[model samples]
Target: MGSEKIRRWESGALAHAATDPFGPGPVPWLRGSELHFDDTGHVVPWYVSPAAPPGPRPATSPATTPRPTAGGPRSADDVHRQIKGFASTGAVTPGEAIDFHITVDPPQRFGVDIYRIGHYGGDGAGRITTSPRLSGIVQPAPLTADRTVSCHHWWLSWRLRVPSYWNIGAYVAVLTTDDGHRSHIPFTVRDDHPADLLLLLPDITWQAYNLYPEDGRTGASLHHAWDENGRLLGEADAATTVSFDRPYAGPGLPLHVGHAYDFIRWAERYGYDLAYADARDLHAGRIDPTRYRGLVFPGHDEYWSTSMRRAVDVAREQGTSLVFLSANTMYWQVELAPSPSGVPNRLLTCRKRRGPGRSALWREADRPEQEVLGIQYAGRVPEARPLVVRNADHWLWEATGAHEGDELEGLVAGEADRYFPRAALPEHQGRILLSHSPYRDAQGAVRYQETSLYRAHSGALVFAAGTFAWSPALDRPGHVDPRVQRATANLLDRICKRD
Candidate 1:
């Protein structure tokens, strides 16, 4: 129900939003009422970019691929450009090669920052979401003018590794420019699951589509990727460099990194051996992803590639379990390219005008492919705080009870029935593990201004944490909240029990 009742409250809430043009929005009393609009008009102004952080950006060069330079001699609104190939998800030729190009620019002023490359399992979680490896020679750091043509355009390549154990996931090359700007390129990752896995294929990477950045020059470092052997692979403890990270030097991808870290941590705590492998590994040897009982995803997961999507579909058909513990999971459109070293993959965020061609990252239709994880996005409501938890006592929440004042200030709670139906689960798979419970109003009216999940679909399981801010609320140390502990334990218990 992406309807207006919520919008009504939203318009009022914005006045106090951090981005508000005026002073703090009306106090809590005026919210959800005409008093919010009292003598003045709306208390908030239109949105504006947040304060820019101090950091370097990846440089681009037009020497390799076809494109204009970054931030140089361009149209007013066209400083960046999107990667050219998107439909290439299922088009890999086993060991075929491909090339990808992208560009980036500093937000403003007369300088440029040094940049790096990211190596992604690509398909493991779909979309492009990790800072895995780097490619090419000459890590050039050109200024704004020179970069538009020589530095901003990212030229990378890849080789598709169609491994025997391929499961739902993609291979990727992440292009990061000077000063921490990023984009994703995806290669399809293949795996063998039950022939019926196609049914669950759509969800393969749903739990962790991509690893989105939390903004600020500092990329999200809360994650690590592992391999099937229980061997530690990608990022590691204290978030040290990966085995190949420094050589690559790309900034970070989106939510995939953080999610991987979160998932691995949870897996270790709950007893699952998580490992990671690239297309090259699959190409050289055979793999068996089903050896593990479940595949995991963690924080801020957002992108998903077609290959990863297909592989996971097969895994589900084979009855493999998936545990998607993140939001905005599996959404980006990624691609892969051929390189002397390996294929380069990237996330598709050409939307940030400060980099590449200043393009947009608006991807529609993640719904059909992303439903496997039990969630899909309608669009981002920037810096929007969602009211979480309605049915506090649903089976998923049996271990805990709700408490007052556990949430951020000014958060709006919605009626149980009014969450985003457009993003709901099909009801045929699993069941609604938990919900953002809603209650009657002072006069006993229901308000559906919160977030909730419904479960359906077969083989795949469903577990929803109605509230959107889990890390700050529950996952961190000293951040104890009864509901979070109970819910966290419940999720692990269910996974173990089912396994």
Candidate 2:
């Protein structure tokens, strides 16, 4: 639609953007309590910008084609037991075939609708393709070996050969059963083509937190599991590794996935030249971070493989700017392994122990997160708190209209980070603490959070937004802050314009 319409929708004035009339009827699996989806099963999609559209479009579709909204039919609770699936790989390059292994309870037919997520004139997503009704069968139960729950569903229910001309972006495969149940399997379409920015989806962390089956009995993630007595098991007793061969628990969407969606909507609305990749791309050396001016980790990117860490470090050393829009980034060092069939990087392994020669917390491994991010995970905020601005006159805040000590309500929350003076730090020519926010932790003790920006010796700008609320503040309803939006734009603009 028009820019004014997009703005009105973002401000919650427009009730709903006209639906793409091409997709299937509302499915019960797509509905959720998130405000993005309205009562009528249509998605309002997240934030929008009033800026002029970028002159060029990606190769996926022409301007005349109508784009689908970000969501399909979903249930209010997103109960995913009836139908669920997972991609053969977290990402697929153009022209490559990716398999979808699905399980339909009680055996039923289903269809997979693929949608590329973006700003799409405020539609939020464009329906790329839909699969023919495929014969779906219940896959075998997941095998729990060494505390790892893996479903190597070798059934290969459906495979799609990505069109050679498809655009590079995040995509989702919506599994809608014949009975109206629906769920989501998220993946990325990647390419060697270079762009101004590279957005890395934290698929590793997504899988790490995925307690598939979530059914008390057969669920296990790297973070938690069930004991024999049926009591919850914490990290100390949880699975040491997790496999990507299974679908996500509950609604099948990763936790904090909306944060990434919010960012994609806001970024593409401005027509920023953006490319997409999965975290595994960095781990497998499939991505050359130097090809882009900036590398963005949009959500809770808490897990990192050694190779993934090296790639970003080398990219920054070569002057590629880095933007981390959420907190608790790179706190754990993980290792990626192949699945049973020898496919690469399908398994993530992490032992949450602190000691020398351990592949666990990076801080315990002598590589503190602050060494690169300029701040490390501080403590969890029991509730939302104001983000108190500090460097109001800094260039990043030029158009934000914020003043020193101004509190951006409820912007420092969830997990938070701060500068640790005792930690090993990277060399920076200059540094600034942008926000100093204080909130009570779960222990009832007050802890401070800080947003930071620092210039590496190679002239690359590294920004750490030290709070999980930062990304949601950019677009989510009730959390959007104009100051946060403008400051983010300023940071990104500087990244793109810097010599």
Candidate 3:
């Protein structure tokens, strides 16, 4: 920005900051905020004056019991008896430490092994960090009413401090016991630097969909259709609310790994200058979007906070480009509250459809996500379909000799998006539809989904892939499309050159 423009922007920001009673620090949780059950049977937010801290960790204890009676370390049937665990924080920067809480069927000595995830080889790649096997006593964290959403601090099994030399990327800690039972806990080592690209992981979406509880069959999540008890909800029956203070389920594969990692592995293979941050960073206003040429969202970034939305909008206004390599981006609104575990931004609260914390479709708020993403979630695609190039001449299709009539195999699958209606669009933006795929909506009516690009009046460029499968198709063998890879390269090359 020119000196005059920079000065004006800084002045305006300062004035805005001064008016915020919390100053420029991380926005503290509203004092005395608690979930109050009302006569309407809704869990509502009732803010009161300052109250005592919930504590540094959840106030519950793991049900410590000896290892399960079932035995057979080498037996395939015993797989279900393995241990499950998760870390307190999802992603942490080097030099910081994280706590791990575990639940063991048969309480035994467990070990924590950390590995950095990447495309190291065809055999698979994840280099073990120098952090030795972190051993601790494991116990069962039984599922009861008081401890459904959040797990007891239980035992702080292991606190691993990331060394400064650890590379910035996704890391998973493997928790194994002497009995041959194992599970995974994932975390990311983040770096703070000016880079060509900033990768924002959808931690919010991960926690919302995570159904990791002792009795997994009935655990809650933003996607689950039941309440804490086993009763089903009527509408989006999925738990409108969820917390991040518990472990994620399923072999520790962080919420369907194929979507996000496919893009990250491919990007890393080419050595793109990349920095990392969880979506919470955007909410906390910790990222200076102008410092990076582009911000990339990999996959399933469904839930978002108002602050995160504002941050991205501001960044785009300042000329920072954005690439949503996934569909269903910024669909629902949510709020962040301090975890009863005392971790800020750890509790994701969204009272979907009703109540004070009701998370209506962003469009209903007159803040349609499509205004920023050019394409909004239309509906789900019943099956995989070909993505027909609508604009062969667009710069994004520079290589691979794709023609307007050509269809990239299965590039449009799962959920997809289409351009928002005229009344829902923001001002001074020009859109270029790239690909269009037809699918059946929930109503059984034929609908078309569109992939698009738009340049804001401020000259910032935005690209939307218009499908959730775009990232997964990048490197997954059966789904990998060379055309998709080339198109992605074109986008990244242009953005990097702009820097």
Candidate 4:
């Protein structure tokens, strides 16, 4: 794969290029950066740099220092109305073409700058390529069908033929209008290449929480919706289905996206052999979990399809270690269906409570998530609380200097999980409860949270962090915990067989 020649699309034609674009070399642009508007109302490149002598490459492999853009809206209420977009798919392999469908509010020119998210000596991300200025238009208003908002923007704003040399990782396309408004569309580059660890991004859960069009008038998520009387409805009354065809409302970035990015930065900095994929890939049978030594769920992975659950179960049975870095995993039972245009897995349907005898929760369906996770959703924390260490002698806490009954400040918050003593549990040789933190719920009820690790009969190890703060603590500013970081590294080192 290292000797494969890199290719790019130019003026609707394929052109040959160097083998490793990120290697030590002059590095030709994917498409020349110099641009001018042509008579046909299209931007065209006016110059291309000639190949030059190769020099010593940077210390980093394939990452860039992203150029700063004007700060845009911070939330849905302040959304950048000037421009927004969504990718045709959540993940694409190298050498495949991906289409970007965009909408410009007042019909102006816009361009997309691509960047790969990673740890580049703390810069966090690097620019990959930039598209020529494209003519944008006001796409048709999103259509609402059965309480689902979908913007099937058929207009192809830009098509990127991903270079074969592009590394497999998370990438973001920044859509910027001529007026300086910017938004982001994130996608992952995946391949069949095997790695020590497989990182599954919680894309399904992201869509479930997305309230697109956040206009305060028309937008519905699996968690909240607006009634005809202009009142907010809770989860029970929210939309039962969600489509991935619309941009994330507000900042155009999904909730908890930063958590996954933080983990990526921390893990990549250690030079871990990691492969990336979307959660949908697991559901569609596209990812072979057994090929990797460990499978990692890095963020808020709450929703899970039956297929996804079965795949992981089978992988665990075959001795593939599992790591759940966030809480509330595999809580819902969902079904994937084709989009209106026949794209597979574009629509996610989860009837929270279909009828008197049916439910979307795996536990209610008699297949408790605890059987696989070793812990179940306990309660939501009203505020941050200390995480009390229970199994201080466990290998997971090695070199952390944590003593028995030690409390890590503010490590427990958001949703959490706990070991259910009387619940259906999987057959394991040994089990250890790592944390025993108690927190107050929104209803003022005091509940206990527990982080757990268990060894399955097949020799597979499953670790559940039991709190949403685990990933954030790995790299988030103001939340970095050296003890938590050391414990996470200890766990990953063993799972990846690096120890």
Error of 3 at 141 (Å): 2.9
Query: 1-499 in candidate 3: lDDT tens per residue?
Result: 3432222111112111111111111001111223333323333322221123421212122211112322311210112435676687777888998888776655566666566655654212354543444454545443434224666556777788888888887766766576755456767778776789988888888777665541323456665544555443343555655767666654444454446667777888877888888888788877777788889998778889999998888888888899999888898888888866567887787777866643467877878888888879887876777888898998888876899978887777777899866736655567799987776766789888789888888877899999867786676645678888988888888889833
Score each candidate by Cα lDDT.
0.32, 0.77, 0.65, 0.77
Reference-based lDDT, residue 312, model 2 = 94
lDDT of 2 by residue, 405-463 (tens): 99999898778999999998889999999999989988899899999999999999999
User: Candidate 1: which stretches are off by over 4 Å?
Assistant: 1-263, 266-273, 276-289, 340-363, 366-370, 378-387, 403-430, 437-457, 464-468, 471-474, 477-480
Error in Å for residue 312 of model 3: 0.4
- Regions of model 3 farther than 4 Å from truth: 1-81, 122-124, 130-148, 214-218, 225-237, 356-359
TM accuracy, model 2? 0.85
What lDDT would candidate 4 get against the real structure? 0.77
For model 2, where is the 10-residue window of minimal lDDT? 19-28
**Model 4 spans with C-alpha error above 4 angstroms:** 1-80, 228-230
RMSD of 2: 9.0
Cα TM-score per model: 0.42, 0.85, 0.79, 0.85
Colliding pairs, model 4: 64-126, 76-250
Query: Model 4 — which ten-residue stretch has the worst lDDT?
Result: 13-22
Where model 2 places Cα greater than 4 Å from the true spot, the runs are 1-29, 32-80, 354-359
